[model samples]
Target: MAEETITLEVTRYRPREDREPRAQAFTVPYRKDWVVLDALNHIKDRVDGTLTYRWSCRMGVCGSCGMMVNGVPKLTCAAFLRDYLPGPIRVEPLAYFPVIRDLVVDIEDFMGKLRRVMPWIIRRTEQPLTAGEYRQTPAQLEAYKQFSMCINCMLCYAACPVYGLSPLFIGPAAIALGYRYNLDSRDEGYHLRQPILAEAVGVWQCTFVGECSAVCPKGVDPAAAIQRSKVAGAKDWFLSILLPRGGRS
Candidate 1:
């Protein structure tokens, strides 16, 4: 009896060496328990030392192992080899981003967008140290809990077609994060974040293709967040018309 093997057609590109990206296949032993990241580790450790990719926690919590598995954005750590059985699994860098090297895309754009969204609790006035903490009920926590599950994975950006067409779009994860903070009961930065979320490149840029929600591994529905933000933006705009000095809280 012979051991079964699987083929992985991985993308290879060296900026100084290769003119463009190309596929390089490698055959490895097929283990039902092995994930795509495991196979990649095997290649880097044994077969080819030059194969480069990013992976931190193999547990899929770090979101650093996101890549294109069979043309869909996925965390390689969660992608099982047995799922794509009996043959080659096409692996590439996440779509709609500039490839820095083989299976590594430049995420500076996403980082910048994330910063602009201000994904943190903000208060106009700070409470005194002796004032204790701003507490919330479990119901209040549940308001923005689902959107807070983002691991900063670029998977949503890769899955978004609007991002592919328009790079200036604020993107799914960033907007969802902004909405998350806005929904926080203790957060008083809605006025501060409104400009960014209501801008042309903000929630309006998302065409609601729904792929961002579809590919989310954390179950974060960024598509719903975008839609909800759009509604909130509209309500604020209408309130601004009615009340000259005040809009939304």
Candidate 2:
């Protein structure tokens, strides 16, 4: 019997060689257990040594293998070939970002946004080493745990049309992470984070498209986080208007 095979339509872009991205097709033997990343790896090792992409910790933990698989943003490591079966699978670099090589999108934008959100525990004053460690209950841990699961897969960014249209938008992952740190019992950075998040291009830029949450591999609901932050910002504004001395005690 002839071996079953699958065709992959992968987007190829070389800065000096091509003006725009172009699709390159390759045929590989089909295996139920093989993923899209595996197919790309086969192409790299056996057929085309010049194909460039990024992948590490193929278990989907590193989140470096994210790509547009059949127009949906996904972790190529988790996208199985069996799901598409007997045909071509369209693979491309993530949308709304500059493709440096083949499937690799430049992540400097996301890195900058992450830093702007201050996604870390902040304290007005650090306690002395003699003090005991900060602790929390199960409920406290659960509050921010889901948002913390984000591995920076960037599938959310690819699925977000807002970010696609407006590159300056602070974006879902950054806001969701900012909310996560705000929810931390040990954090007091909400006031600090609010300035950036409450800016015109922050959470308000999101039209509640919810595609970010829909495509999140980790099940983190970034849309909800953004809406919640909006509510918090509004309440803060309302308080400032209604109370004396600017409402900030």
Whole-model lDDT per candidate: 0.94, 0.93
Worst 10 residues of 2 by lDDT: 240-249
RMSD of each: 1.1, 1.0
lDDT score at residue 133, model 1, on the 0-100 scale: 97
Pairs that collide, model 1: none
User: Can you write out model 2's per-residue Cα lDDT over 149-235, one digit (the tens) per residue?
Assistant: 999989999999999999999999999999999999999888899878988999989999999999998899999999999998888
TM-score per candidate: 0.97, 0.98
